[model samples]
Target chain A: TLAAPAIAQSAPELKWRLTSSFPKSLDTIFGAAEVFAKNVAEASDGKFQIQVFPAGEIVPGLQAADKVTDGTLEMAHTASYYYWGKDPTFAFATAVPFGLNSRQQNAWMYEGGGIDLMNEFYAAYNIHALPGGNTGAQMGGWFRKEIKTAADLKGVKMRIGGFGGKVIAKLGVVPQQIAGGDIYPALEKGTIDAAEWVGPYDDQKLGFNKVAPYYYYPGWWEGGPMLHFFINKAKWEGLPKNYQAIITGAAALANTDMQARYDHLNPGALKKLVADGAKLRPFSAEILEACFNAAKETYAEMNATNAAFKKVHDAVMAYRADAYLWQQVSEATFDNFMMAQQRKKAL
Target chain B: TLAAPAIAQSAPELKWRLTSSFPKSLDTIFGAAEVFAKNVAEASDGKFQIQVFPAGEIVPGLQAADKVTDGTLEMAHTASYYYWGKDPTFAFATAVPFGLNSRQQNAWMYEGGGIDLMNEFYAAYNIHALPGGNTGAQMGGWFRKEIKTAADLKGVKMRIGGFGGKVIAKLGVVPQQIAGGDIYPALEKGTIDAAEWVGPYDDQKLGFNKVAPYYYYPGWWEGGPMLHFFINKAKWEGLPKNYQAIITGAAALANTDMQARYDHLNPGALKKLVADGAKLRPFSAEILEACFNAAKETYAEMNATNAAFKKVHDAVMAYRADAYLWQQVSEATFDNFMMAQQRKKAL
Candidate 1:
């Protein structure tokens, strides 16, 4: 049974500003906001408009969340982990070291109680969060020289993200937090021995391969990091239900689209990098083992000290246990066999 | 600038019927249509409503696509590959043997030109398609006895879907197409030696574990089988832009949610099955390799004769090549290591 159509012919137009934590140059990351805005506008028949501002255009990249929470901005598109310093629990919202990959992350957020848990934590800041985008599993930054063992990390200054840096630091490596735009120069000038950004698509855009020839993979830190659209609680609640639905739809579309773009673009970008003399290498089992152990210790320490972090960490670990079991049997088995077969044929 | 919302308050409410190819008892699979309909009505403020009909309510399950195209029903929720009997190219729209996993399939459909190419093919049938839901990577199937080698498949009578059955038929297997509601009885009565439904979640509901004690995994044939929302071309185009957006948003939500629900539910369901004296087994490497080989030969033969099938198959294979490479380096590495660690800890 259908209800009578109730949309008014002269509904007033609504406009809002969205601030992103990424600069325009990193189009894929920051560009997701524009994609959300454009879809919203087109879907609403141009009646609802959102103007996107790149990182510094409104608030600095890392401060977009604070602006949104304070209602200085209506919403923000930013990675939640950028604010992990405020509370380690923030890392759970975006990603944690060695956490779920993109699909599992989505499962956690949508089904495994991640959204409710994260939102309860975020409610303290007067905001609502929607998963806006994901940048598939990232590459382990670019390295100037191959890393053969855990001992090789000693005194190696690497530009890594916040929580991952903390975890890796225990492995006798120096971790530095540098802005996205500044990572290239730090790696080029030998200020940092290695730097990790996103995957192949973003890495190529930043020209990291040209400066660092050993392109290592499996960014153990930011496995399927998700971008969030943080809305001011009051601002979000005041909208019509239809408008809310539109926002939900637009955000989901953007979320799915962003990863698809990365999956499509990264393969080509990687080939180009390899063609230009970039060597593809996997992090040695020894180093990966070292990092994994260190990551566990770091999580343990954080849980012992921070109750907020502990609550989310416990939940994530439980969900991950089941998820990992299922995926290993299904995804890993099929992929491992198919990849080996495809590679052999190519050779 | 926002234009005046031109919707009339007294606009007539629109009502449509959606036929689904799945029985209502399989809630997660068939329930996706209900979820889509509910979201659409709520998002549109109840002005647009769709009533869902389970298989055999209005037409047989396999006839959903034809009903939608003929406008006997405005829409249908079904897997595209169900119609592969009509056109082998139809299999590409859902899943084919050894096809992309859930994430890779989404990437190909949304970003890698899969939608455009598939739509071009669908246009000839006067139908429009949307990625509706996914079952993730499915289990191999329920078997009466363990299959230890490719030789074990000789003369075995198994219930399989259309295209997959064709591939396995080459390896000395007798493939039978049985209706979903009849599979359980067929397997129970020894009329069919083995059967494949979905994963643990759906199989448990169908009560297959009671008869088939051996449960094998990695449904290589239906890796990430996607359900499609088929709309009569004229009906879709006549919808208002805002309504169309709502449909897109609702469909995307259902698409993502269905997979999450399955992923979340399958783990628990599997645990229950194992506890109930069910034996979990992996198809031997020999059988998997043989099936993989047969699948390839089947594709090559089809491509040599069917122009339409080749057109889509070539695109899917090319896209698959690149997708496999990237996922291998990123997703597989992370998942394999993490799973191994978790298993070690458990042991």
Candidate 2:
């Protein structure tokens, strides 16, 4: 019989634990972790296995990064922006108000030195990061009333997430930080006037459209929000180079899969919500302009105080300018024409 | 000493050859094949090795798929539409006139039943297809003179690639199938009135701006053209399940990487092309509308004669309508706003 190859003989059996920031109920977001785990195990021939746990099963969702950093967990899948309270720089790894869109975000991360810059900052926390998924541009929120102007936002209580609340608060809106499970009842019972979740597919599951008749779009705060896989640096450095490459490739697959899944599912969900009497609206230009200005102010304040935030912010803004310029010339033009055909039902 | 595991002992030593339809000089397109090969080797710890050869190294560029189908090559990296003359249904795997954009293509392929539909068609040819890369939306082409109206195309000889030639032939334009190496000389000598290769990055390498002053926006025919990894069905099935999973994940990585590279590189390339005296123009609404109508006529003719073509085209069109409707609501709106900011240098 032929001798087994030296490399094959050295293949070791190991198991890892991963904590997810989202519950399994939100399959599109939470499912990315499962996809990553499945690919890892399959590629390793079950020699390496990773067990996934949903939010609160191992640690609370917001504390996931802490668990990974302190070596309590091997990895955690969560949004980087979820940890902004610990350091504002974490926001750039996921998104900031008026940040890059999905394609732009991917381009920046993969080719525009975003990964290097972000990983440099993450190294200080004893962690390494890889982009796990993106939730394309999200809807503004489900609202009980239409917001026709910036003035309409004043004093309205809303359930919002992450750093978005800081910027919106500058506009006189009361931003509530409510958990995903609590958002529905809070809106339905008049505790909050409006609430923002993810896009149509995920939001539809929570039944936000049933109570709030007005559905608004183009969630400026979370435009192309990305989620990340945070790995403990010590654990990562100890892995074989082959396993490292497998993990990197698996993360890339999961990253692309989530956005594709969302794009495929959101269309049907949006149509269903509208058929059930949800009124779709675009935030007026006056309101978007006000929020854009407010977001700038918030960024300026952070930049003045946080050098880490400033470095990433400067790099992102520079890339943003060029990415949009190129996009307008080709992608936007092609898409605009296709959209007109769809409206005429000519397609 | 511990005994070697049964699975590790079973790991086989294998080598496969992959032929690319692109030359090495066009690094972004050809480089995806390299990326795929690198990940496969790294993931399998050099046990499963794939050697990549550029166009003509094994067979001519256009014959890549044929080589894989006949088992002359184990796999190939090529645009599926290159084989449209064999069957118009192959065009759906890559792109079609006025079809889905990059994001929508991935969504359709990964989530909207495109993989199953295309694989079913490919099964007849003894091939399996996986998306390997996308070039995003392409530029219209380089023209010696501006085409201000549909009438300007009359009797104009243009060098265009497969499938698009058939659609554009309806507009009274003469189409020439010129090789990449010969396009510059043809344009410089007025042998061809216009030629298109790809968007800015690849196009810049061809130095088309030196000969043709008029560059145009939006190659409507090749919107989000995807390249595929075509594998021999017998060879694919014989691989261990671990190897199959590794290949699948690698292809997904390559697919996402290509577009990200294009998006990152095109911006600077466009700026360089403009500075070097390339006059940019848009295909007027009148010209685009004429070509759009002509494309519809061509598709109708194909649908009437070809059962496979009709089935795939119908599915794409149905999904396309809803995809654009949702995109216009969020993505287009947000991108339009960012572009306006870019124009004002406000970013």
Candidate 3:
């Protein structure tokens, strides 16, 4: 109780910088970091200020985790999966192929022991992790041509992200790693046949509809790709408990707000995409089944070779299995029935 | 810049109390208020302390909002829909029959204007609202017998909540308003043929499955029932901006954590119930269709007479329509396929 008196004393003003892996141009995704910083400043009465920088300003977007680890920056807002090369376990922090959706991801992280497990792994890298934002289940991609079967994937060069690319590679697709800026030209100029990005909101912004007419649903590879706010372990440890709580609270707000924005904004963008002649398509069951198998094989191979990957992968897989079971009986059934009824009315 | 020096001065200690509609036994639901209080106290270094009281501790559970409005309590952590007797508009701040699920509800409240509209309505009652918790989509209820058709509902006494009861009333069913503690006894004594509390987690704790063997799912009435933190407007306005921020952050954390806990815990709870011979069932298509129509009709009638109800209803309905459209193409399709695949593997 005596601590209350000391705590009421105004805390020291602190300033931090956050570098995001996303470009400022993609506001819905990158804007989440800004929202967190604003919340922190306001919550602390401007005492804890965090200045956010776009991808390349402080460090290259892909190098955000390293810089934070090295304490070059106090924090970084980026997708953990972006650092697949550092350790495959990083993918588990963000999204792996056939990973948890946004709701399920939150459940796994907050309640199903995922945050603790991931944090234990993160401790080795001198980082502390917090869920920052999420792009709800993304779209499959914009494809230059229709993909009807597993055979359709042969020789197709797709600009896909890390773990997902590895999965599809087994289907005879040539997985091409390319930066965001180069994806459109590659798709348009026939250098790549397909490209996967976030969802309707970000994809529409990138003008993917013009370059590729076949818009796909259910980015199965990323059921829900979560972004993280990585704090330098030493810096986080040094903060007063109040400041830590403020940071925790701000990150939680940003996490929920990002998804709300996407859910609200993507509908309008999808409407525009369809109106502009982009054909929306669902990946064939055959193709999806094949990809699922390949994802399993990819995981098995990695589990065999990488101890860290196996640890995180095992935890995520166990949590996801239970989540999927629960969702099937509740969310999945309700949605299926409701959507069917909705389509009937439309017809 | 000069304000920084003044803010550093110690703030006066403040203590508040929150009354919850739930009992302490139901940890996840009632526990959210406790979580919020703990976070606030910790973040404020014990300066701003909130003591949580369970329902009936200070006042009857249903009276939480009125008590907060009159400032008998500083706040109440309860579902806004509990005050449906005050005005049907109250349900929009919570959940309406056949309305948005958890994710969509968050989208509507945070992004599609539900929060602002609901808060405007709440202001008239001298309360300010913040989303505090959620129990994802609930089960329909525990039923002693099969409800295979709309006719099956006739003459059935069901212990249901506010707005949902009104919608289902058209099917010749007798809708009984009973407190959570009394539901099990009523079901056991045959006073009510069916009853709904929350999902598998809470229902199992209440021993509903023992009396009612048929456990129906997808509580259509409460697709995503959200709880609210109702602060006395005057009390809220008197707080420092920093204190308000702490409250906001704490409530957001509780809101997300409540659902995560339910989602994580429910799967295991459900498995245990089924193992104990509780039969899991889905409401039939014909019955669901009839209920949907009844719900729409009920809303229409309310809109015709209730101005406040009309305002919130209009906003929520508009947002939900857009959400449904987007979800069908994305969440619905993906979940349906994924669940089917999951079921196949299980088989």
Candidate 4:
């Protein structure tokens, strides 16, 4: 019932500034802020306004959350993993290796009370979190060579985020957390031999195609990556009910919009990537097995050490387990058959 | 290229009967269907094969094009609109007085598009469509209401379907065609007293809270109706895709799973509705007049001739010129904001 209430003919207008970690080129992610600003403007009939800034205009992409936490800016767009360097527990806020896909993530965060728990944790930083947008189940990083065995991973520098990197790091490879805009250069300059970003459409935009010729499938680290609109807690709580609804609505639109955009664009971009001489490769079973073991070990290690991490980790894993079981019975069975029906082209 | 040199598999999965006007459930209208049956027999290892039945089912939802097509299905899930009294496009779908709530009607329909697109449309011949979903978008049915002037809705009955029979007869209303399973019901039920469906959370489900206690936001002749999955055209192309997919996914999910099973569990369902009691009212003069002029003049005359409608009016309308575009901008923006902020309320 936050319908526009009867108000005096003239009420004071409000203004705010929001900064996002994404570049405008990635319309789905960056578009969220644009959407937020536009919604606020329309809801108040332009009486309320917000100025949007893309990443690096104010701070490094990874640093947006800190800036929001510090209130250097009233709001920001950030992924939770960038802050994992500050606290490993941050990984759960974003994603983890072999984690839940997009729908599962939304379930945990929205209906499963993950939002309340996350907010409780985020409250420590004096910020409010709204589920922003999500990039559904990303593809594995682009690599310079096909990974044949676990040995190929040894010393292979890759830019992957959150705890997935740590799990891989245990495999003796160096893990780097490079921002999206910056990944191309890191891979090009040999600062990293491989990098994983979202699906093909985004990777195509970043032109990773030119730098990393071997594109991989299934970015194990991020089954689904969620983006967040970090609003200053004080700024958020003070808004009139209508404005709150407007912001929340804007974020949800961006959530579905991005996924659709990605879905529509990825297949074509992927076809183009392969046509452009980018080699497509699948991770070998041996490598996947080792990495899975490492991820389990790392998760157990974190659960043992961090109380906050354990609570969320346990809840998410539990949900993930159920989701996995259900999907296997219902979705995966059909998918694998369809896949098996199609044979690979002879090498 | 992953393309294989065609080393013949078991002579292709062969004939199948797939019923859907959509992809699987989670997305693409009626998407869940594809997802559902796919997993079932596959887990059993392809012992069961299925043929797909899309809108038209074997034929088409709007009668003209399909004409009793698919041979296999003695059945299908579809909206009643495609038949509409075998004459009134509204009757075949669901309610047009704004009719039943998504849940109530779903109970009516599950429980069968609500019996009318069926009995009326099917009695004409060999095929039938079922009730696949109810979106819940009925408004006070989008009145020219807010109508302070006598000229408000002088003659508007709206493009109402199903429920149009009950009220339009009294109010000098001229209902039109529009589809959104959620909010179209109340509009025909005589709430804004006018309405439209298909924009924003299916309207029926959003419950028409916030903006219209007057409930006059988007009836435009829609009262949160229902969608049907059609089947026909020569016995469903002679059946084969197993016994599932077409009727399963979203039907299991969106239809039965969507507003029906979940409606009661919805957060803030009642508090929001009654606090506003949503001021359940009817379309008044003057406003209904202007809408009638716009809707009738636009359609009345058209129904008389127009080859397109001449051919299909009994079922579907000529495609609205700007439905998709208008859907993207202001419509998308306004609704999405309301959704995220509401914290899951009941319609």
Order candidates by TM-score, high to low. 2, 3, 1, 4
Candidate number achieving the greatest DockQ relative to the actual structure: 2
Model 4: residues >4 Å from true position, as ranges? Answer: A1-12, A177-191, A333-347, B1-347
- Candidate number with the higher TM-score (3 or 4): 3
lDDT of 1 at B320: 85
In model 4 chain B, the worst 10-residue window by lDDT is B318-327
Native-referenced DockQ of model 1 = 0.61
lDDT digits (tens) for residues A1-347 of candidate 4: 22122221122367777788878888767876775576546534455578888887878777788777887888887788778877676777677876766655665775566678888888888889877766766777788777888888999999876677889998888988676779888888888899987777677878887888987766667767788888888878877654564555455545544544554455456667777877877666567667767887998898888898898888877666544433322122222221222222100
Shift in Å, residue A186, candidate 2? 1.6
> Model 3: residues >4 Å from true position, as ranges?
A1-10, A345-347, B1-5, B8-10
Best by TM-score: 2
Q: Candidate 1, TM-score vs. the true structure?
A: 0.96
lDDT tens digits, residues A1-347, model 1? 13212354223378898999888888877778987888777767677899999989978888898998899999999999999989989988788888888888888898889888898899999889999889988888888888888898899899887899998899888988788779889888998889988888888878888888998878988788998999998888887786787788778778887888888888898888889888888888788888888888898888899998999999888878888877877667777777987787630
lDDT of 3 by residue, A32-52 (tens): 999889888877777789999
Which regions of candidate 2 fall more than 4 Å away from where they truly are?
A1-5, A8-10, B1-5, B8-10
What lDDT tens digits, residue by residue, belong to model 1 across residues B1-347? 14223454222378999999999888988888988898777766677889999999999989999998888999999999988888899999889989888888888998889888898899888888989889998888888988888888898899987888899898888999887789999989999889988888888878888898888878899888999999998988888877777788778878887887888888788888888877888887788888888998999899999999999998888888888877788667777778887788631
Cα-based RMSD of the predictions, in order? 2.5, 1.5, 2.0, 23.7
**Candidate 2 lDDT over residue span B259-343, tens digit each:** 9999999999999999999998988888888988999999999999999999999999999999998999988888888888889
